[model samples]
Target: MKINPLLVGLFLISPVFILLISYPGFSVVDSSEVFQVFKFTFHQALVSSLLATVFGALAGLSLSSIFDSKKYSFVESLYYAPSFVPVLFVVFSCLNIGNLWQISFKGFWGIVVIHVLINVGLVGALYSKILIHRLSLMNRLSLVQGLGVWRYLRKIVFAHTKKDLLFLFAVVFIFCFTSFSIPLIIGGVNSTTIELLIYEKLVVLGEVEQALSLALLQLLFLVFFLGLINFTQAKEKAITTSWNPFFKNKIFLLVPIFSFIVLFVGLWLSASFSLGWFTELALLPTLIKSLGLALFCGYSIFLFFQFIFSILPHSTFEFFMSVYSSPSTVLIGLALVVVSSVWWQGRWLVLLFGYVLLYVPVLFKMFVQNFLSSLKPALKVSRAMSANYWLRFKMITFPLSYSLCLFLGFLTAIWVLGDYALASLLLEADSTIALVAKNLLRSYRLDQASFVITIIIFCEFIIYLLYKGLAYVGGQKY
Candidate 1:
């Protein structure tokens, strides 16, 4: 696998450039204030995840009650829509309407609402599946005798779902905890998160040492949670190869899908004056940049997956614990590994590390990481005696990781496309599509911004389809 010169260059430039703008100095070290902020971010996320999970579970359970009805299928699609949209669009649409009504999307509570709204769909979707699985299991048991609804839930629902629920909570909590844009845009001084604060330390404070300190700290927190998750984690679920096809009966299910369409469409029409002017502008350059960053972001996921594939034996979660027990552990661990292996030093590695930090948890909570981690241990033992790098990877790593690398790569690519925070920090003035999207939005060209967003998402959908095709050929069986 020859490295792409452009990707290497971009990776090298993105993080290293931070050193130029970043302030390496700090006012007196307020370990106390930093600790307080740390405590607050976790506290808020815990509240947000718990409350949101309840709402999400209720929302998901509502779907279970509605299932087999023609209108029910639309429910999941509606729940999924917000999760797919860029957060900025949601914030803008909400703010546009709220302004007309003189309501505020500001401070802590507002941030929580947005977090819940964004994450509930994900939580709801997963819970719906969990509920559906429970229902199916109960159906199997009903052949012999009736289990009361409460008994069914206690024995089958809760009994079989310890790992799934643990996975969901871990996910929603980390997402809220590390969240950046929603909090940054609407948070003002009253709302903050570890991700936003890291941005502050790096971009605002210009404190490199402190920024790195904070980044290191954030990394440790994530690894800690990752470790806890692995402790409770169960065996990996095999990926379902069959796609559920949409049918005519599912047409009524479009109610929620249409509900979603109507909502966003209404927002678009109401904000037309803002969006109209944008639709007329030349977006070719910005389109190209968005595509470039998006492509590069996709490429980044593949490379990071390689790194993930590198440390297979001890669950990455377990390694995370061993590595983050001390900051020196991370510094030393990398030193003996990738950092010392090459001449490179700086933020590209950090940015790549950021992507790992970015994807691994969400993916872990989603169970993607766990699956990847599961395959590599046996593969690594095979590699220990292999004669060549490619031979070892091809025989042991890639084949074992066949389904994961492809799916995770594509899923993460879609994710990285919507990544505004990482793009904001790393991309040069005109290099990033997200920056361009934000530029358009900031410039009041809402329509063109929507166009750009649509195009980006369409590209992601297309890329994912392509990856799915390749996944079929791999014979690894997803």
Candidate 2:
């Protein structure tokens, strides 16, 4: 019997679609209030995306010179630290520093600052790679023609890197637009984004019609941004060649680079580390729960991806995969909450199912191209032999990508472990360590939360090594 791939894809996305279609009749109870929230969301996201892009460019350009001087490892902390550490830790660290300076990061400006701090390093790293990769040609042209700094920037830097700049802007914008955790934690009720509104309607007020209406509105924004991302990616591909190793002596760049490093380290130390908290003894349970959830999410999502890939046509697979990036986490989480409200007993199952739906597209986008390209020969051979789909995957595809899949699984698991927003709605505080940490912070248990965050960071480091080890072992064998 044949299966319809589109149907399968739709089935996979039914959770999100249900949220979209389940809207009751629209009632504009407070259209003005809702519109105000919409305006706030738009303004904050726009400003955050713009500032992040600019700061990222500065950091990236500065780091490029350092990389060229072969001091790349010296600033690896600044380059990679943001991603390795959980976001909440970063948020708390910033809040802590603000307190030290008597600054209140309690509203719109606070959200923007967190976003810029979080995204600046990413943008910088991107620029650093691009600059270093093309440094030789650029340097030669500028030096030979005696182009001044401004001219070189205008003629060479902006000309070649604008696509990258736009790409970064779009990505950061989407992130800010759909932001849930930062806004929820820092923005308070009045400063909530549309994504937060979705959560409020579902979890706080049980306003299903209003929630669905807002979700549809958010989806429209997502579709527009995703299209923008697609366009920018295509344009980037057309213009971009890839990055590193160029010799340019720009000492001025180091100032921004060092400043960025200092800012991050200061925040990290101030917020996440405190002496004498390790002996709390309750730390182990949180660690275990987080680890367990991560493992479950990582492996389940991977298995589901394999299942989907084996069944769907490539086009259909891509279409379904794109849908993954459509809804924000809060949106997806609330949808799951609504669905689970019906069965009541299997909310955990629905939560995990939601995890797969929400994150599979992410993992798919990350790994599919590399995995598919690598397994092409084996896949072709299996197809030529008329092997069944499962047989083909089992005999050919799985072996080739097992190590990679394991790595992806662990990565996904780490992300799940770090995640507080989605888990906030589904599981109790005790069930997910992230929730525990989040609550600890809210309850003014800063030292304890910091200790917990420190543990989470350590676990992330261990998982990172494990992921790299798997890749290394796979490299040798495969």
Q: What clash count does candidate 1 reach?
A: 8
Least well predicted 10-residue stretch by lDDT in candidate 2: 234-243
Give the Å shift of residue 126 in candidate 1: 3.5
> Clashing residue pairs, candidate 2?
133-244
Q: What RMSD does model 2 have?
A: 4.6
Give the per-residue lDDT digits (tens) of candidate 1, residues 26-88: 444367768777877887788878876766665655555553544554566577767766676
TM-score of 2: 0.80
Model 2 spans > 4 angstroms off: 1-12, 20-29, 64-77, 129-149, 235-281, 301-324, 338-346, 360-410
What C-alpha lDDT, on a 0 to 100 scale, does residue 331 get in candidate 2? Answer: 65
Superposition error at 414 for model 1 (Å):
2.5
RMSD of each: 7.5, 4.6
* TM-score against native, each model: 0.70, 0.80
